[model samples]
Target: MKISANQTKNSLFQKIEQVRHRQGKVRDSHITLAHGSGGKAMRDLIDDIFVSNFDNPILSQLEDQASLNLASLMQQGDRLALTTDSYVVDPLFFPSSDIGELAINGTVNDLAVSGAKPLYLTCSVILEEGLPVETLRRVAASMKKAALKAGIKIVTGDTKVVHRGAADKLFINTAGVGVIPKEVNISAHNIQPGDLVIINGELGNHGAAILIARGELALETNIESDCQPLHDLVETILKVCPDIHAMRDATRGGLATVLNEFALSSQVGIRINEESIPVREEVKGVCEILGLDPLYLANEGKLVVVVGQENAENVLSAMKSHPSGKNACIIGEVIPSPPGIVLLKTAFNAERIVDMLVGEQLPRIC
Candidate 1:
């Protein structure tokens, strides 16, 4: 028997689905320069890569701007925190995240770690002339969704086109506004000897994932970037231990950089127990194979908290309740030692020094 018109229509739809599915296959080891140009290559990159990984309602909408309705009550305080960062990842996109998501999270994390509740954000786009409009839309859409998840708004933005060779395919600069409650205060200068060190979760995942995505180092691991928003987690910690001495997000310089900065700012030393620090076996193995130090590896979602000794358990309890902080642990403490130094206690009872990365290990990674 001949197929009905309805059945013919159904068959056509199935054929279209198969065609779309075939467009996203990843055969190349690295992103070709064509991936950024707003053409067939760029469309494939966004549809197959970004959307597949960060599937969400706001993202699925694929609109020029994400519709949001933030509560006015959330912006009560006169005190506010503002932060900005430029996204310049050499590869632009990585295993777990791209410059788009990183730009959002990076600014939000800075505000969160500073005890501010982020509210509004402004994004500036520098697009290379040949860049595809579709890719730009995808990135803007990602920013909108990330801002919504962080409870912030993309209130204002600007776009500028640059000569093809003058700039990378794209670079994003994001600035955020946040309200700081009068009662909450987190500062590196507030750190004191005898305070305890608590980390939100495992380190090196974001860094390791970036290195692998670059395809330079031949190593394999399941580590994906831990890039995420941290406002909710920060809020919980503040609620339980309102007297927290200091809080910082471990980003570019990793735990070592932030810790050393804190030590210097507070004029104190930090003693970290090697056993207490959390590291995934996969990340550790990758680090070992590459001769990279986990301590200096970057992290996106993780946080470092220094709280008074009496409130350690309270802060830890708060941290554990949040998804981002489920693996939180007391890693070390502030101590009276040589000013601005961080000491690591090894598994073999040996002491070693940990310092800031000289320049950059995995460069252009957020």
Candidate 2:
């Protein structure tokens, strides 16, 4: 049977109408104070955007709080892992990702590094009055997509509208919950001498991408934010090395900060060779021109893991097999002397202490 073009068009329109009927569309083109006034406008916006995109069994119930079964979670681990982060990236949308995905990945990584299987998340967003509704739609869709990819659910959320100029267009806060397996016990205090320091991927991609996105330096590059979920990668590593000592997602303070933290917490010295660290040329150029250290720049999808010597090879090989950990390498090793310090061995064969920075070079990069 041959279908007419008119029939196809009518079918498409019918589908669109069905969606609109199920999830009412926001009548306003832009957000207003009324949308956050706890009235009809608020209901419409939530039903049309967030609820529609983040549709799930729990969220669809539209309860004030999402309830989870403790028995189901207990099957995965004995302890719960919870992490919260706020994303105020200067630009809500950037080269490869937006604040929505950043919020999801940041919280997910925080839990993943602790050897947990992420379960649920709560997203709270504040939108400035006069902001375009389309922007919010895109963000909501991104969050839903990211949550699906990470195999987690955004069970509940809140929204608010602030006066124009009082807010930076949008700010999102997220709280995540996960379950740590009974056999896994990862912490910075587990670090020991002869342990290896390994990173999952190239450092500073996110910082460089945001810097280029801002167009502050009048420079152009192919850098894109390395924003992604790392739970899968963590699972891969654990499959091969269950006794992993410590793990941390290198975020705002970069790898240097994470290394310093591990060193200080474990009271052991960490020495990283400059040559072993992987950094893209674009990031190196940006850092050199601005007199900034790439080690101190932020990374959204990078991990720093310290493993004992016997399991280092297995962990490195396991990580390399995973996409997120393709660039995994041992940048340093733990030492007995010079406790509570991190030293970087430069390309010129000189050693210098790597200290924690009082501030981040790229603020609001998320």
Candidate 3:
């Protein structure tokens, strides 16, 4: 077979055009201002770090807004649930988790605690100029893995680069949308006397993990952040006890903050025994040494659940059967008197108020 020179030139031109249009690797080692200028550099960054990892049909179109199927969402439930959060913890990478996984799990927990089946998520990241491109790739890979494990998709997102001195290493913001069934209604307003206070597992792991990551205290211990998605655990609870009065993830403000919110919202008092609350010995040692209260520490995967007295045992049993709620326990019960107050009964038979955090205990603990 004989090929003409003109045909060879035409083939070469077509191949070059294809390479220019297709998704490819980012060539720069460190991020620059030009990467966020809506030009070729930005496209390369998104294609290499984000779109390639968060590959999905909706995001593949490269549109400004995600095009969703209304009928598809309706099939899951009658109502839509939405939540948004930002992650700016110092030291973007921590033990067992990073800012990327934290952002996905945090938003998912928000939706799950509301009795919604998490469906989709939108991710946006602010990158400081001069950040290593590998760091961005690592974060994007983690987000992809976390979203995949949670059975959710990243449908749309944006990226911006700031001056190196103006911002930290990297920050991520995420918004999630889910579907809430008609039968499920979980809220703080539904709390009442005779309800049981339940927590999924040990508290303060996240705060302790972050503190250790920051190297503020000279300590040594094997502890990891309890960062995880909780939709499955919530679903397990819904199957057994659909009439949950109130439920919330013990996140930034931890167990005390959540209990106080329930009490104030429902105008009822919550009494929990100190012995019933779970805390790792390492965490306790850290708190005790630092003269800090573990109850107010942050947690990424723990939740405070309040259910009717009749359904308390059933919910507890169901939660214990799940992976996230293995240490589930009823720490307290709602009392009729002293509305808007949370009473913590110490192990020595003494009691005190458990109030919301007044000021920053551990900064940037997200």
Query: lDDT tens string, model 1, 26-88?
Result: 444444556556677655655665454443444446566655444553556556687888888
Scored by TM-score, the top model is 2
Candidate 3: regions farther than 4 A off: 1-24
Residue 336 lDDT in model 3?
89
Compared with the true structure, what per-residue lDDT tens digits does model 3 show for residues 297-354? Answer: 9999998899999999999999999999999999999998799999999988999998
Positional deviation of residue 189's Cα in model 3 after best superposition, in angstroms: 0.4
TM-score order, best first, reads 2, 3, 1
Output the lDDT of residue 196, model 1: 96
Clashing pairs in 2: none
Compute the lDDT of residue 120 as modeled in candidate 2: 95
What's the TM-score of every candidate structure? 0.80, 0.94, 0.94
Count of backbone clashes for each model?
1, 0, 0
Poorest lDDT segment (10 consecutive residues) of candidate 1: 50-59
Q: Provide the lDDT at 169 for model 1.
A: 82
Runs of candidate 1 exceeding 4 Å displacement: 1-75
- Global lDDT of each model? 0.81, 0.92, 0.92
Better of 1 and 2 by lDDT: 2
